[model samples]
Target: MDLTVIWAFIIAFAVFAYVVMDGFDLGIGVLFPTFAVGPERDRAMNSIAPVWDGNETWLVLGGGGLFAAFPLAYAVILPATYPLIIAMLLGLVFRGVAFEYRWRDPGHRRAWDFAFSAGSLVAALAQGMTLGALLQGIRVTGRAYAGSWWDWLTPYTLLVGLGTVAGYALLGAAWLVWKLDGAGQAHARRLARGAALATLALLGLVSLYNVALRPEYAERWLTAPTLWYALPVPVVTALAGLALLRALGRDTHAQPFFLALALFALGMAGIGVTIWPNVVPPSLTIWQAAAPHRSQVFMLVGVALTLPLILAYTAWSYWVFRGKVGGDGYH
Candidate 1:
């Protein structure tokens, strides 16, 4: 594979991983209000605490990779999606602050907990909006944003935004099932089942709408043999969704969450492949937007070493934090 192509795939994969991992924590935050009081919420928070910050490493890597490897695309996309980007950052800020303050201020823990949950909801919504806007394609004229802010908030984009929220919520519920036991696990399983159904409906709607609105995408999928191969992603994802439902019904926690993550991974991979060669989609192809070869080479060397370290540390942290959370305790 060409160097630029390799970097593109690596960066895309990293972003997808971040979405699948950190996404659940954010979803947990969004779902906090529903779970209510005491050990349950604390367990939910604790389940993600050890690795939440580390999960963001991939976001940084993905963004940095785009900046380094595809400067033009970054310039175009950042300018086009500045509002949503700012919203996402603000949500992250709220979440981080809430994470620290909720633990320290016993007096106002309830308020902080709500803040954390709200932050998560806001962040997930913003991310979904951003994804929707990107998929809808930015209006670029000679490398400049040629559209108004309202252009990013179309009906299709709104559908995708809500779809992503449901998707992340499902992931979060799946996570809770695995991380907590007894009442918490049961509650989480119910939440997961509900979220999964909503996600399935939203996914179907978004897929149908996008195909009709952007017929080119449908053509690509139908015409290209390689793209046809990517169809199994959705197929397998649906099967996994069914399996998760079955497992939830049987009160099987561990396997359901793993299967849910697989479903997410497969969907992400399908999109990545569908949009391959086009980092910014519709307009800027990776090679067309890529920075100088020397810059990409230099960045690759550092990324090669650091990425593994990040992965290892993340895995180790999860391993250490593995098992049940209880009684609003800190260790």
Candidate 2:
């Protein structure tokens, strides 16, 4: 396979992993307000406390890889979306501080909780808007960003941002359903039902909005050759959505979480189908933005070695922390 293509898939996988892994914990924070005070909230927090920090590793890997292997794309994209990126980073910082401080200082736990929820919500929204702005196409002039500062803040971007929030909320609800029992689980089920509906509705809206944003998107998905590749995404996404709703109603625990993740996976697949070969969208193909062959090969060697290690340890952590959390478990 071509080295640039290999690097592209690697970066894509890293990003996908980050979204699915960190997404749930962020979702937990988004749903934090609805959680009852005391044990209910504590159990919700404890459910993610062990694996939350580690989940962000993929974000670092994805960003660092993009900078290393696709510097041009990163340079242009970052400048165009500086506001969103800054907001996302700041949100992450506050979320991390809240996560740590909530435990250290009980006297100010409520403030920390607010910080956590606000930070998570902001981070999720910013990330989604960044994706939207990129998809809607960043204005590029001779390999540099030519767009104004506020270009990232559009009605379409806002729709995607809200969609992302709803999706994360669904993931969080599904996670709670799997990780908690009794009343907490029941409450999570109720939340998941509503979140699932909102996520699916917004997913449809985003896909339609994407097509309307650019004819290229419409051609890619609706035209021949590409249509064959794109056809199954919607079909499978619908199935996953149905399965998720069914799982939410049933006695199953892990099914709801995994099925919810499937919905995200399908959505990512749809995006890949729509924008493959293009790193910055409407322009800047992966080949155009890729680093030199030697740099990519050298980096690939390191990724090949470390990727498995990251996956192994991440899996190990989850396995170690498996089973329902209740009454101050694993805290």
Candidate 3:
């Protein structure tokens, strides 16, 4: 494989990691209000506390990789989706602050809880909107963003945002099903089933709408016989959704969580397949947008050294924390 192809796959994998890992944790934050105001919420928080921080490290890797390996994509994509990116950053900051302070200041736990939920909601919504806008294509004028601020505020974008929220909520519920027992698990099962159905419906709707609206995507993923292999992407996503539904009542705990993750992973796989070679669709490609060879070579050395360290600690921490969570965490 070419060097650019290798970096592209690596970057895509990093993006997938962030989406699957931080995706569930963010879902937990979004579902915070579903739990009661006291120990229930705390237990849910404890379920993710051990690994939530590392979950986001993948996002940093993705952004840094893009900036290093494909600076042009980072530049154009960011400018096109300016509002969504800013809002997402703000939401993440707010959520992180609330996560930490909620533990430190008992007096303001309730307020912190509200902040956390709102932040999670906003961030998830923004991410969904960004995906929607990106799929529809960002407006570029002479290699610069020329769209209005509200350009991304389309109905399809809003619908996709809602779908993303539902998907993340399902992931969160699945995690809870694995991490808790008894009452919490029961609550999670209910949430998981509902969110799964909702997500499936939304995913169906988004695909149908996108195929009708974006002819380029339709041509790339459906009309072309060569791309037929990518059909398994959506197929796997649908199967994962069904598996998640079936696993809710099953005795296994990890099955539901992994099944939910499988849905995310399969979907990402499909997207990567559809957009292969193109860092930004209908326009820029990986080779077209890549940084100089010298920069990629230099960055490769750093990524090679640091990426393993990140993965090692991430795996080790999860292994160490394996087992059900009971009672409030950090007590």
Candidate 4:
């Protein structure tokens, strides 16, 4: 296989990892007010506090991989999706500020908490919108974006944005089930059940819409050999969702969360396969968007060394903070 293709896969995997890992935590932040209040909220925050920073490392690596290995794709995508990118960054900034300020100032803590939730909502929504727009393909005339700003913010994009929020909420709820106990656990389970149902419905709707818009996708589904191969993803996702539901019903916490992550991974894998070799769906193929060989080679050297270190530190950080948050005070 080509080195560019290998780098592309690595980068895609990194981004998907970030989404699956950090996505649930962002969902937790967004849904904080619904299931938690005061100290419970603090505990909820504490549950993710130990490893949240490390989880974001994948995003840096993913973005850097794009800039280094596929500079042209980066240039095109960043300019076209500038607004959504800015929104995502701003949300991250607000979330970080809220995370710090809520713990420091007793009186204005509520304000900061609100900021955190709002930020998470904004960032998640923006990301989903970007994904939808990318799948729909940009109007690229030569090297420039030809689409209007309004074109980027369509009804389909908005629906996808909401779907992403629901997906994250499901993830967060599953996390909470594993981390909390008694009332918190019960609450999380309820949220998880509801979120799972909603996510499934939204995913179904999106899949239908995607196939309707691109009839080729339906053809892909109809073809026996291809459909048989593709069936594993949705099949696995459905099985995971069922397992999560059963685990939640049985009050089996840990397995449900793990299964929830598996369901997310399966969904991501399906989409990745659907859009293979197209970093900017429909418009730019991976080979067309890749940077020069020399540039990619140089970037690979740095990634080869640093990626493992990042993964190790991330794993170690999570290991260190493995236990429940409880009333042990903030770290």
* Most TM-score-accurate candidate: 2
What C-alpha lDDT do the candidate models reach, one value each? 0.82, 0.93, 0.85, 0.81
Ranking by TM-score, best first? Answer: 2, 3, 4, 1
lDDT of 4 at 12: 80
TM-score of every candidate relative to the true structure? 0.95, 0.98, 0.95, 0.95
Residue ranges of candidate 4 with Cα displaced over 4 Å = 329-331
Compared to the true structure, candidate 4 yields what TM-score? 0.95
Residue range 1-331, candidate 1, lDDT tens digits: 4788878888778888889888999989889999778777788888888889988988998888888888888888888788889988999999999999987998999989888988888889888888888887877788777878677778887888888889889899988888888888889999999998998888878766766766566775666676577677778878887887888889576887787787777767766755666776677788988888888888889988998898898888888888766555342
**Tens digits of lDDT, candidate 3, 253-303:** 889888888887776776666566688776778998888888888888888
The digit string of per-residue lDDT tens for model 2 on 92-121 reads: 999999999998999999999999999999
lDDT of 1 at 10: 83
lDDT of 1: 0.82
- In model 4, what is the error at residue 229, expressed in angstroms? 2.5
Worst 10 residues of 4 by lDDT: 322-331
Give me the displacement of residue 57 in model 4, in angstroms.
Answer: 1.4
